[model samples]
Target: MSRQFRLPLHSPPSFAREHFAASPTNAQAIAAIDAWPRWGDGRLALIGAAGAGKTHLARDWALKANAVVVEAANPLAAPLDLAALRGRAVLVDDADRRAQGGHLDDETLFHLINMAGVDGGTLLLTGRLAPVAWDCAVPDLRSRLNALTAAIIDEPDDIVLEAVLRRAFAARAMTPAHDVYPYLLRRIPRSSLEAIAAVDLLDEAASAQGRAITRLLAGEVLAFEGDEGED
Candidate 1:
């Protein structure tokens, strides 16, 4: 029988500007954020897949711009009140969700876009889908989204993937031996989300077994992941 372990629950890794790993995949997106205030119409959209550094970049830009960060889960939530924001810059992560089905609400986001543009304040939105693809119902909202400058975080290459894997391990306070990184990199899919998830699972496995990360342990974890079982 296979043993099981309950993974500890924890908040996502806290974002910090210095901790972000930059590569060709994300340089353009980072550059766009760095060029803030100068962005045309004072707004921009960043599109990338999960774990593609969109949140990290958004958080860094928010810190630099003194912007308020809000998820697209529900724009009407307590903090999205325009009156409360005044003329502050705002960074909305997963803004694409709002486009699809009003996860952030078209009405509130429309107001936010206008507010962020007022008085040189800027708006930064991050999501997995491009603004052009947002299924907005409101005419004004559709036009506004269409007009915003857009950037993309491309799929990571080997170097960036390795960096991301290392960062994930570090976030859990586990330092994998030098060889462990290359080993996993060679075996796992070349995706930031996948790499992060693998690291998370490996960390929990190690924690449950009271073992340091090693070639054997990593192989065990990956082999278990490969088993689809009695499907």
Candidate 2:
């Protein structure tokens, strides 16, 4: 087989509502967001593991509420105007990572929570764990997290995972064998993150080896990754 150089291509993930694979798994979170201004305490955390569609849902809420979206890491480098955020919708993505990431300090985080909690603003935070479980240097911040309401997004079901896999491949403009989904679904861990990883590994293998992705290629890749038989 003739080899072909595969240049790295980047396809940014879309956060639009239409791009989201909505299902009962995330319906609770979606409903919590839609409940909006009436949210108990005016603050809520969408908690889930990676690729569980937290960011996508956050984006959808941001659009509907005209919420300001900011990475948890950006605050310390460029602090936001607390007064301006009052009575508005704000989303701080990856907020739980900030405590250990050294991107957001306890004081800043404390104020963010305080502002929304007491000042009539609506705040949304996304993370894999609940805010109360996060490691916080400030005792005050830790206390506030306990009062913060939270919504959980369960693991993606078969339908959602299938949609995720299909969309990921389509986004990369790669066409695998028609049997790819069924063959791999029962074999790999049932999670969107895992599905995307499978597609990524296969895509890389196909490009590097200059061959189309088939069950054989996929199996080789999965075996190499040791991600098989985890259904």
Pairs in clash, predicted candidate 1: none
What lDDT, from 0 to 1, does candidate 1 have? 0.78
Candidate 1 local lDDT, 1-231, one digit each (tens) = 222323333566667877777888888998988888888878899999876878888888888888888878564655456777767788898888753344367888888888766776788998888897887778999998888889898987788888778877877899877788777766676567677777778888899999999877877776735434411
Instruction: Compute the lDDT of residue 57 as modeled in candidate 1.
Output: 83
State the RMSD for candidate 1. 4.8
Look at candidate 2 and give me any clashing residue pairs.
none
Predicted candidate 2 versus true structure: per-residue lDDT over 1-231, tens digit per residue: 111122233566788888788789989988887788888878889998977989888888888888888688553556677778777788989988873445457887788787785656788999999887887878888899877889999988878888988998988799888988787776667567677777888888899999898878877767734445532
| Candidate 2 segments exceeding 4 Å error | 1-9, 74-76, 99-103, 117-120, 208-210, 224-231
